[model samples]
Target: MNDDRLEGAGGEDTEEHLLRSLPGCIVAAVGMVGIAGFVLFLVARIVRSLTT
Candidate 1:
């Protein structure tokens, strides 16, 4: 029943940890989407070249 043991070792709670990591998570998500888009674009270009 000790709350201190339940909290983070750095004294920050789960919400605080998520808030601090939010920006990095956003950047990672955006980068993944960008890479996926680029790959799809390349695939489309290759398909178009093969068809034409």
Candidate 2:
């Protein structure tokens, strides 16, 4: 009952898995960048408030 069409079949290391996971990785990277930008913006605002 081993079908090649099935994915995540326990200890399977294939290129298809990498391809399938690529989009998730990209989204995660974008989210991290967005969070970093937000934090920087908040820090800048705090700095400005302290100076003024």
Best by TM-score: 1
**Clashing pairs in model 1?**
none
Give Cα distance to truth, residue 33, candidate 1, Å. Answer: 0.2
In model 2, the clashing pairs are none
Q: Residue-wise lDDT of candidate 1 within 14-44, one digit each (tens)?
A: 6776686789899999999999999999999
Instruction: Tell me how far the alpha carbon of residue 23 in candidate 2 is from the true structure, in angstroms, after superposition.
Output: 0.5
Worst 10-residue lDDT window, candidate 2 = 1-10
Off by over 4 Å in 1: 1-12
| Per-residue alpha-carbon lDDT of candidate 2 for residues 1-52, written as tens digits (9 for 90 to 100) | 2343365564474577778778989999999999999999999999999999
